[model samples]
Target: MAHITLPDESLPGIVGLFNFRPETTGALQLIAETLLRGESSLTSGERELIAAHVSYLNNCHFCHTSHASAAMAHLECDLSLIDDIKQGFNQIEISPKLRALLNIAGKVQKSGKEVKESDIEAAREQGATDREIHDAVLIAATFCMFNRYVDGLGTWAPQENEAYREMGQRMAFTGYVRYAEADL
Candidate 1:
């Protein structure tokens, strides 16, 4: 149950909140679309991974699970990838650039100032462009806000991973803006 009387109580997480305040949904969705689905050197999967990682660090189950599912959809991988990321991405064989960016994202989840000069240099050394780094930070920061919004409101989420798998496929193929409008 949500802390407030959302318009559609059954809709989980941010979706229910969006229904409660339709006016804010467009801006939020636009931010999501531009940051995660927009043209960038980083793949959508990588962006979603950053979002998931930050959400995980925050212990926001809804954001973590949803973004992890989206990451899986974009990467076309199985649940093992999600498990690897949750267990610790360092053990996985992801690109060095992504690992470096994930490091930055993790630091940002704690505090933006936690990102050090050495972190930026490490990402750059791994061939991460300024835009990619920027996006990674923005994604992390945005997800922090989003995770708070969802969990703070006490919104509900489906317990099963299958629900998120369907949501993930929709997010990956439909994009955020359209999905927001459709849901509205």
Candidate 2:
């Protein structure tokens, strides 16, 4: 059961209908909008990768699995990359730039203050533009919040792989929020 019972069909604020309210929903909508819009220079897949990486670091299984699926859908890369990164990215086939970006995200997960100048410089050396580095940090920071929210509320996620895959496809294509239809 949800922490709070919201109206059926209502996309509650936070995950699990806790404090179902418009402002919270609006915030969630805006976050999703910004992520999907790719307001930063990072590709949609890279953004999702950042989210997944943070989720992994935080050990938020639901967010990690869901975002990993989303990343695979958008990037069209091997899903094994997710497992690879989870196990060890140092030996993975990903580019140095991606490794540098993940390092930044890892630092954010450890603690925002832990992100050092050398991290930024390393990313720059790997050819990450200022915008890309900025977006990497933003994505990491945002996912840290998202991971805490999901785990804090203990939201029940759809467990079936098929369900997650479907969600990934829909979200990658149509995004998180959709326009409301006219009432009959």
Candidate 3:
């Protein structure tokens, strides 16, 4: 159970936050859509991975699992890939550009100031665009706030991983901004 009584059980994990402050949903969705689903060189899977990574660093269980499932659904849904990413993307054999961006995201999760010009340059040299780098930073920063928000309130998060599969599929099919087909 959350620190406060939520509206309903349908709203699981961080989604329950909306119960207390429904007004913020619109704004939050806008940012999520723009950063996670907006046009960019980086794929939606990659963006979700960044969010998951930041959540992992923050030790926010709900955000990490939920976003990891979303990332997996968007990509190949490769459990191995998601596992490797959560563990440490550096050890994986992903693209150098992605690795660089993940590195920067990790830094941002710790402290936005930790991101250096050299990190940006490295991402650029590895073929990441300015928009891609910018998106990664924003996603990291946003998830940091989200993680804290979810954990700060001592909100309820379903313990089972299977619980997020449905939500992940919903997000993958209908973009975050689209509500008609999405249970989210």
For all candidates, the clash counts are: 0, 0, 0
Task: Give one digit per residue, the lDDT tens place, for model 3 in 123-182.
Answer: 999999888888889899999988988988878777666877877777766766633224
* Candidate 1 C-alpha lDDT tens digits along 1-184: 7889988888898988887887788889888988999999898998999999999999988888888889889988875566677887754467999999999999999999999999999999999988889999999999999999999999998876777888888878788884455554
Q: Report the lDDT tens digits of candidate 2 across residue range 1-184.
A: 4454555423322444434554465556567657645466667777777788888899887677777778778878655555755785544356789889999989989898999999999999999998888888877888888877776755566654454675566667777654232210
Ordered list by lDDT, greatest first? 1, 3, 2
Off by over 4 Å in 1: 90-92, 179-184
- Provide the RMSD of all predictions against the true structure, rounded to 1 decimal: 2.4, 4.1, 3.1
Query: What TM-score do all the candidates reach, one by one?
Result: 0.93, 0.81, 0.88
Model 2 clash pairs are none
Backbone clash tally (model 1): 0
What is the Å distance of residue 41 in model 1 from its true position?
Answer: 0.3
The TM-score-based order of candidates, best leading, equals 1, 3, 2
Which is better, 1 or 3, measured by lDDT?
A: 1
Q: Which pairs of residues collide in model 1?
A: none
Candidate 3, position 171, lDDT: 73
* TM-score: the better of candidates 2 and 3: 3
Model 3: runs farther than 4 Å from truth?
Answer: 90-93, 178-184
In angstroms, the error of model 3 at 12 is: 2.0
